[model samples]
Target: MVRSSAPLRRLGAELRRLREATGRTQADVGEAIGRSHTTLVNWERGKNKLSKSDLVCLLAELRVPADVRKGLELLRAEAGTGTSPWAVYGLPDWLRPLISFEEDATSVTTFQPVIIPGLLQTEDYARASHATAPQLAAPDNIERWVAARMRRQQRPRNDPHFRLHAVISEAALHLYVGGVAVMAEQLRQLVKATETDNITIRVLPSSRGDHAGVANNFTVLHFANPSADPPLGYFDGPLGGHMVSDAGDVAAMVTMFDDLRAAALAESESASLLAAILEEYQ
Candidate 1:
């Protein structure tokens, strides 16, 4: 019974407005609620859903009057019975959390060993790539999936706090799912995306032996919400996707990323490597 996030997002916005109206900083609000400033920040930014107790405390501390509190309580109760829109389309249940994370992430870093990360993929490239995916190949479902992926790209434009960094394997650039022309265009898009202030692209050359990400694709999502507990890790599998948020697991993934970064080419070198591959495709 995951609810549509609209209510939660609105709640966050209202909380922020209320705090501002009261001329209270996040720290001040946090102090009143006996939580850390970061946690309060996360709440106001809609990066994390509030627990029942946390919501009650927040409403009390914010001095939300009876009517507003009752309305919020109703929304919360309703949230428990509604399904996430994504579930209707056959996305794996576990992957649902990633949708919310993507919506609120301030920054995302991905290590893709096999394919172009989805957010940067062109529509034709995504369609062709999905055509071979047995589980996702149903024509109707594929269109929905492609639409979802394309929509993910809109985040950077819509969310001023959003930033992305990607490290891609050289093999991904050379694989011509939609032929040389499409691949070439995709590479050009990557180059263009790199020029953006909030995006960075790096290539892990095929010659770079024994990389840490040889095993899988993984992403770390960092929240801008000061109240966010911590960054989270996600990866895909036959069962869809899995999220790892336990402190130790998240730390290990972060450490792995750091090691992989060290093993891969520097940003400039990676860009040069990507350019060379694009030239070959041309």
Candidate 2:
């Protein structure tokens, strides 16, 4: 099943906030609306959208002010309309939420321990990386995944307001993901990407040994309207990935990201190290 779209998630979150303000449990609100608590839970979680009448009933049950009701109606309209740009890639259910969150985020920060961060990967590097997975080894699957990634990369490259900071492991530079030529070009592209003011790339030297982000790769998305939609944390896995929404967990992820950045080399030094490794590949 497809996950909720970005607007739907925001709407759900806002509804949840209003419901909490009224000090009513889901069961209480569900009973008042003659719907099951489970149904209300789904609506509040963004797993399912409420109908217009249902939204009206919910607002009435919560006794929300007119201004609040108007804003929610607008959000509901946005959630109900249009298709996301990534809809064409046929991305997996679990991956769609990540794309949706990234698309709406004002800035993104990622800590990569093993390979290049997705938003900074070149086409060849991405294809080579995806080819290693048994499920994505097919030519069509590789191409589709690569295309999705490339399209996603455009946000950080083209959107002046969208900023990206990538903390990469030193070992990633020597991994030779796509062999000499591909890896060379990938590094060259990484070097070129640093020339843009919005993109900052740093390397966490292997010498830093056993840091805050040693376990796996993770990405954090920060929005312009943080009060309505707080920061989100995500980590990929064998099946798909998991979105971190709990306030405490998201806070920890942010702290870990800060530590990773501190452990990494400065931008200029990272660039110098990248150049040194590129020489080895040549």
Candidate 3:
């Protein structure tokens, strides 16, 4: 089955918003366009593509302004083009949606048991980590992967409205990803991130023993408009990664995140741990 993508999701969200502005139910629009509400709902959910003709019909039925229609048309066009800035990195198809969804999400919650979260990794640390992955062992692929990872970091760092909460294992702190100097700087960077209001970093102490997140690392993306763009869960594998969109699956991830948070050190205490680790490296 063809999975829904970030571009399609964004486009669908815009369409949903427009439809809401007109105060029309999906059934009403569907009837006007000679289609079933299920079909319309699928289009609005990004589960199915919206044809050009149908889009035009829907826009006309809604009496959208010419300018608004133009913008929607542009979105529709982009939905099909498969063009994301990070696409140039030659990332696998399964990976691009994770980056794209991250770019559009209002908040992201992540758990890392083995290493630093991608958004928190320093350049050298990222390089070191990528070099160990078989798929990214090539020098060029490592650079590209690092560059994409760095670019993904900008959203959480720079956008106040884009919140990031990371629950990381204490073991990850001692992994020494890039050796002494790189790990030191990476730990220092984590401490620095704690100063930001939008970024929350928590450490799951090793004393916690077995935990809900011990199985794997994962991230959940949430949108400002939940009805249109629902929460999504993503996790990596040996070949690539997969996005989890089922409401139940995403809810389970949320539960797991809450459990991790309950077991993790508070933000301030985590910062202290980070500082202590940084000193050890120094």
Candidate 4:
């Protein structure tokens, strides 16, 4: 699928701000209008284009002020006028919005059922993870991808306001992506990430059996500016990935995050587990 055009993305961003102004969840507006939160999410993220009538109804439902609504109408006309540079970097079209969303997010809560989450991965671990994929065999391209992943990690670590709450499964820790040394380093990195005040790490033990996030990995991104953007939910699975901004969908994802966090080991205990596993590699 083609990545959403910049204009469409702008339209989405505007709609997001309006929704934030109203202080409503995508689910809340979706329910009132008998639409799914996914619809709202896509619309705001620019993945799903909004039509004239749909826009009319949505803006009305959101109680968008007349003057502001007029500006949005103009933005809608210019939707799909351009593209994102990430496409040139070999990133998939579908993955673009996720990267963009992360750029603007103030806080992120991620649940990973297997493997460490991307932002926390070391270069070797990332290479190994990608190298295992036969489809992405190009070494140069892999490096580009790895470099991009590393770039994504920078702001979250340096920015005092970027909060990351990552929940991993015990299975992920045991599964060696790179060799023993690489895995060891990755484990150490996971432990090191905890040192940041804004970063929180938890582990869901295999003994727990089943949990809310067992099906797939998902993330809920919270924007700092309520008037400019609202919370959105993103899912990564077999069919690329999906971004959901509906109040209902966002709420459901939030619930899932909470449940998974509850089932996961406490931060201190998770660190201990990492330390214990780190020893085996040593």
Per-candidate RMSD vs. true structure?
Answer: 9.2, 3.5, 6.8, 7.1
lDDT, candidate 3, residue 261? 98
Give a tens-digit lDDT track for model 3, residues 1-282: 223355687777778888999999999999999999988876776645688899999999989899999988877776654334665787766777687678779999999999999999999999998777755457778788888889888898788989999999999999978789999899989999999999999999999999988978899999987886789999986677888877999999999999999999999999999899888999
lDDT of 1 by residue, 1-282 (tens): 665444565566677887788788999889988999988876775545677888899888888898988887776664454445565556545656688767657788889888899889999888888887767467777777777788778987566568888888888888888899888888888877776788777888788877778988999987765343367789996557877756678788888887777777887787777778788888
Better of 1 and 3 by TM-score: 3
* Tens-digit lDDT string for candidate 2 (22-64): 8889999999999999888767866567788999999998999
- TM-score top scorer: 2
Which segments of candidate 3 are over 4 A away from where they belong? 1-7, 10-82
Stretches > 4 Å off in candidate 2 = 1-7, 18-42, 45-54, 57-68, 136-139
What candidate 4 gets wrong by more than 4 Å, as runs, is 1-10, 13-44, 47-88, 136-140
Output the better candidate (2/3) by TM-score: 2
Residue-pair clashes per candidate: 4, 0, 0, 6
- Indicate the worst ten consecutive residues by lDDT in candidate 3: 1-10
Model 3 gets an lDDT of 0.85
